[model samples]
Target: MFDHIADAVKLPDLVRIGDNLVVARFETMKVYSALAAVEHLLNTGAVQPGDTLMDSSSGTYAYSLALACHKYGMKCHIVCSTKADPSVVTQLELLGATVEQVPIPPGPMVDKMDLEVRLQRINEILAARRDVYWMQQYHNGFHYHGYREVAALIDREMPGAPLTVVGGVGSGASTGGLATYLRELRPDVELVGIQPYESVTFGSEPVEDPVASISGIGSPVYFANVTYELYDRIHWIAHDQAVAATLALYRDHGIFGGMSSGCCYLAAEWEARQNPDRQFLFIGADTGHRYMSSVYTKHDQAVSLTGLEPRGIRELTELELPWAVMDWNRRPYEVAPKVLPC
Candidate 1:
């Protein structure tokens, strides 16, 4: 395993969605490192088969978990931020799961907040009165084990192949866990992590082409698992490049995906040109339709695109994690308490 990582390398494990289209196709789901870990947990009695599932999401993770819970006869109680699209909330509820939209985050991305921060203060308030389970994506000192199973899957499906893995980060579960597995299987393989320039970190830098628009990969919470030691290189994709990739996937391969996946593919293509013989795998986190109101429309892109307003370049390290903040609401709640349960 150590032999392959000679040049700032990573273990390759990329989970993909079929067609990578803007339209959502629940039926064509495929688990990469995360799902593989989740499935194994289910099989080994590590993850108990329960009557319910609870987790926070932006959109794609919620849908993925909701579908998984439903298949296993488990009800899903999703506590999502207000930024998640309404269609996603409606879909989960219609699928027999209860949806709780968390209000009062200062911005569009609330999941980025740390569990130790002020928003978590509100969460404690809700959990105090409610009966829902707190599905801590990470347990103890371990990154989410969901990526472990994904690693096993990669080992079986792709043996001895030099892979270029690309995807976003959230709980750092997918990034840390999968990287762990890939390194174990083939130490020489490279693992490349991706992030938006607007929210840069260890593996990223800001791009001036467009403003950040995608979701699911970047976060305020830093995981112990996604270490500099585990990664080969971190690349920053501009929001415009991401959008162009999304449109290209739709126009060329007929895959309609969010700008985030476009970032992944853009990275993949970049890697491929550098190593044409190597197989590059990428995670298509979600469809673009969820972003139709944002990246898909021309007027939306024009008004909000990078060139329009022109935000300056940022280092991934400079962007703040939402939880890095000390308070959730310094001012009084304008809308009286909604009396939400956990």
Candidate 2:
């Protein structure tokens, strides 16, 4: 008697942002948008319910997967680093999912099966369970170009303004696929690939110590999606600068966001200042509420994500942060493409 709930990314309104000035209103569409796309991919006569989903992430998406699993009563085995935000973890548990904590230190090389290996390890864990649906955002070439839908909408909404898109990645799907789509629509567009100070797997890498500030993007190793074919230029953001920028946005604009989002937002600000005629556009992957112990919160609280990444610095706020939580920007992230398993 009622309409069934479909995926999140497919809805026309969900794919585009209506507001330009206020961020909160604009971000509402992102969760459903990403989910819709992911679900559509699954519905392609391939995936089904009751299959275990193995997703590894250091941020909010892992939790989102847990909730998505609830709809089909699928088992969710999430791989998270010691460095992963606590709020992300809490939500997964609430959805009756399991979280495996990575144990290790940086750089010695994490075995894809090592608990500390995060997504790489989740790939291994699900290997033993044939019924497990391992969804890697990487190998799946069928990118919905969710960003393109948003970008075109933004361009149309704000005419006479140049659109500059910037962000970092490990899966590199957003950077590559979105760039390809936007360039087709607006050849003069500038798609900026933001990398951390260290891991420049693609593009002309910046000169800096280690170079990568974000763990997922700028990986020391080349990821499946981060190919050379996808970008106009590369911009590097310092870890501290991204942290500072995120804090500044929270203080000034009251926009609580994650690291990659922070990088894109700062780059957008720089673009807006450089080309006043352009209306800068960027992606906000998730809310910063998940990051209470780190850059998203106070300053100087201690926490661990895993050995492959740095330990988090705690914020000094007296607020008791939950180990994990979920809000709007939550969605699934795959290290590889999400394809169906028999």
Which candidate has the highest TM-score of all? 2
How would you encode candidate 2's per-residue C-alpha lDDT over 1-342 as one tens digit per residue?
A: 313232432232212222332132232233332354446646784566666777656554465456556655667777777766666677678778888887756564342333335655666776666777665554455443455665565556545555656556556776565557777777666666666643435321223443234654565444566655456555555666666666766666666677666666666565555566655566666666655666755544323222212212232121111111111111233322322211
Q: Find the candidate with the highest lDDT and give its number.
A: 2
Question: Candidate 1 residues 1-342, lDDT tens each?
Answer: 332111111123233433221111222132232244345556766556664557666466566666656566566777767667888789888777777665654654433442224346446745774544444453322335545655676667766557656666544566566667777887755666666644433433233223443455554344333454555655655555567677766665666667666666656655665665666667665567777866677634432222321122333334332111111111211211321122
Alpha-carbon lDDT, every model? 0.52, 0.53
Per-residue lDDT of 117 in model 2: 53
TM-scores for all predictions: 0.66, 0.69
RMSD of each: 11.0, 10.7
For model 1, what is the error of residue 291's alpha carbon versus the real structure, in angstroms, after optimal superposition? 2.0
**Candidate 1, lDDT over the whole model:** 0.52
